[model samples]
Target chain A: MRKREPRVILSFPATVDAMSMESYSAAHGVPGRLIPLPTAISAGCGMCWCAPITDREAVERAARDAGLRVSGVHEMML
Target chain B: MIYLDNAATTLHKPPQVIEAVAEAMRSSGNPARGAHGSSLQASRTVYGARAKIAALFHCPRPDHVVFTSNVTEALNTAINGLIRPGDHVITTDLEHNSVLRPLYRLAAERDVALDFVPADRRGNLDYAMFSQLMRPNTRAIVCTHASNLTGNLVDLRQVSAAARAGGALLIVDAAQTAGCLPIDMEALGIDVLCFTGHKGLMGPQGTGGLCVRAGVEIAPLKVGGTGVQSYSPTQPAEYPTRLEAGTLNAHGIAGLSAAVDYLNEIGIPAIHEKETALMRRFLRGVRDIPGVTVYGDFSGDRAAIVALNIRDYDSGEVSDALAQDYGIATRPGAHCAPRMHRALGTEQQGAVRFSFSWYNTEAETDQAIRAVRELAEE
Candidate 1:
């Protein structure tokens, strides 16, 4: 197994919305995938878009271009 | 079995619909909950379903289409969310329990004044009577787009005009007619359109929703987490989240979207033509059977459902005989529209309904007609 590292995640208001974000990004060829909201980040019903820390700014810009809502974006260790 | 209880639930779903549901479950995740590819795919599936539903219903805002477990739940949300204590509302005999029971509870608990515009024995509404019943404080007019018991279509334009003049919101239960009939909510001046996916839309069970017109504010029936606003103590005040609480039946909606896609490809008028032609064939076959009686005003547009009776036979007995003896399946009794049954004087014997769909063939309709003929002769 490979060593793990903290990755950037974008939490959303609702699960459907998080999925919407992912869809827009993929359509625009942006780099990211949706994952279950990290439990350490206050237990809630939400999903986040995760990508490389290096891609954070690019992903944020993609989200803005696609007009998707972002709850919060954070980088935390796995 | 020659299934004819479509008013209860459509048994024959298009193959694409069945596959789409399975595909969604296999490929998607709890959308909006993740930043991963699977979750993103799920989110897209949900959005696709919402957009398709909105387009089909001609709802201006796709976000206003809120998913519920079924039409019953959607109707409850519409009724309880909109009607307040001391408010006046109107309905009619041509409604399923989904529409009537909520109003009944609201009338009992909230002291909401309720009035029903009576229907003639033929399941025909006197639109003029609706004019007489309108009042200044009437908050909503909740009724069915088509009668589940008799297959009669209401003149929604006339009903909406009444609702508009009286300053009441028109909430239509489209359970019986959503897929078969064309429902342009804005063009019809409808405030709230509630529907189930299984009946006309041809999706699986547990899929239904409401299309809220832009400015019509219906209160949220349930409040909880809406993935986006986790910090908020109450449900978020947006379109879908304001009404939708908890993980939606994403799997079922996936199926609903596929069904909508199929409907769009085939066109509603083609589906209507096929189903109605079958209905006419069955009706003509059942005619001249000595003791057979048909109910409802078959004068204009209607669903593919036909309610009938064979002289003095218990409706259940007739349905059972058809099922066991003829390998035909049908629904008997009041069909959850007890008031309509009463109006048709089917209080004691009830009625046997033979509903049709695109999957049904002319041969099956003929078989059912023959079965009823045999039963009538007995």
Candidate 2:
């Protein structure tokens, strides 16, 4: 198993929102990749944007500019 | 054969659309169902298509675009999800059965009241009737942007004004006009815009969807397996996920995405101009032909369609003759527009319909005109 580390997870209510976030991030150099919604997070059963904890601010800013339908933001250990 | 029945479904598609579908079949996995590269690729392709459709129709939110199997499914979703029991709805005689049947079922099963804005013998709607048909309990005004049978474009601005004045939602079925015409849902005051990707959009047959306005809420027709809220008994109450359930047609959507790009590159106005020109040419040739009677008003903006009957002959016989004798293809009979046919007073004879697409050439148009002339003479 990999060693545990802190990660910033952004959750969306729908898969389309997460995909939008991914698209916006790719276009604007936001730092994140989509991962399956971590079971620890109770938002929804769809994909969520996961990034390094240090890049949380940048990711949040990108999502705001993109007007993505993000449901929740969480920081957790992986 | 020179295929002219484009309103039914475009017989020719851009090569990019074909290639995109082939590529998706080779590479894509189930979208939003997994985190693997293939699944993500499928997800991205589907999302890309949604964004393209949203932009093309001027839908405010990309996430609000929900994919369905075809215009029939899209219309079903919009009609069934929004209209409630005892709600007063206004449609038009120009609507295809996709709009009529659902509203009919609602009238039968849900106690909904429906009134249709009548069309004249020329297939032109009396736009003033839109407001007159409105009731205090009116929930929506559902109609087509253009008639599939006659090719007459409805005056949506007038319809939108009526809907707004009556405080009712305007749901437009863009089956005949979507990719062939530029539609700004916001500008047109459309609450829900239903479109099929195959006909004017020149995509795979299985692709279509509805674009809902931000604040509009539609109860889903089918609910299960959205891949979100898996444990919840209720469907996720989000824009798209609220309506979309089960696996999506990602491959078809991939093709639709490419088709949109192709349309963008060519520009919609240019395509409309070419198609309208072909339609006018065909009209000029056949309108003066003896024993020929044509349907629809050609004096205003319309789709590239011409419906005509030759010398009291059955429309099926004329269409079959066009195919077997002239090597030309056209649609015949009811066209799922029983009301439109009745309005034109051709309910018994039906009509031979020739619809044009961007892929059709002047030579093909002239050939179709010649075929119709010979058939009328016979």
| Maximum-DockQ candidate | 2
Q: Which lDDT tens digits does candidate 2 get at residues A1-78?
A: 888789999988889988999999999888879998998887456789999999999989988998887878999987
Worst lDDT run of 10 residues, candidate 1 chain B, spans B31-40
Q: Cα lDDT for residue A37, model 2?
A: 92
Clashing pairs in 2: none
Tens-place lDDT digits, model 1, residues B1-378: 888878788899999999999998888787555545776667788888987999999998677899999999999999999999999999999889999999999999999998898888898988987779888889989999999989999999999999988888999999999999889999999999999999989998999999999888888999875666577687877678899887788899899999999999999999999999999899889967899999877667789988999999999999999999999989999889988988888988999999999889999999999999999999
What are the per-model DockQ values?
A: 0.36, 0.68
- Candidate 2, residues B1-378, lDDT tens digits: the string is 899999999999999999999999999999988778999999999999999999999999999999999999999999999999999999999989999999999999999999999999988888899899888999999999999999999989999999999999999999999999999999999999999999999999999999999999999999999888788889999989999999999999999999999999999999999999999999999999999998999988899999999989999999999999999999999999999999999999999999999999999999988888888776
B296: Cα error in model 2, Å: 0.8
Model 1 agreement with the true structure over A9-52: per-residue lDDT tens digits = 87765554565676678788888776667787757656677788
**Candidate 2: which stretches are off by over 4 Å?**
none
Instruction: Give chain B TM-scores in order.
Output: 0.99, 0.99
| Model 2 collision count | 0
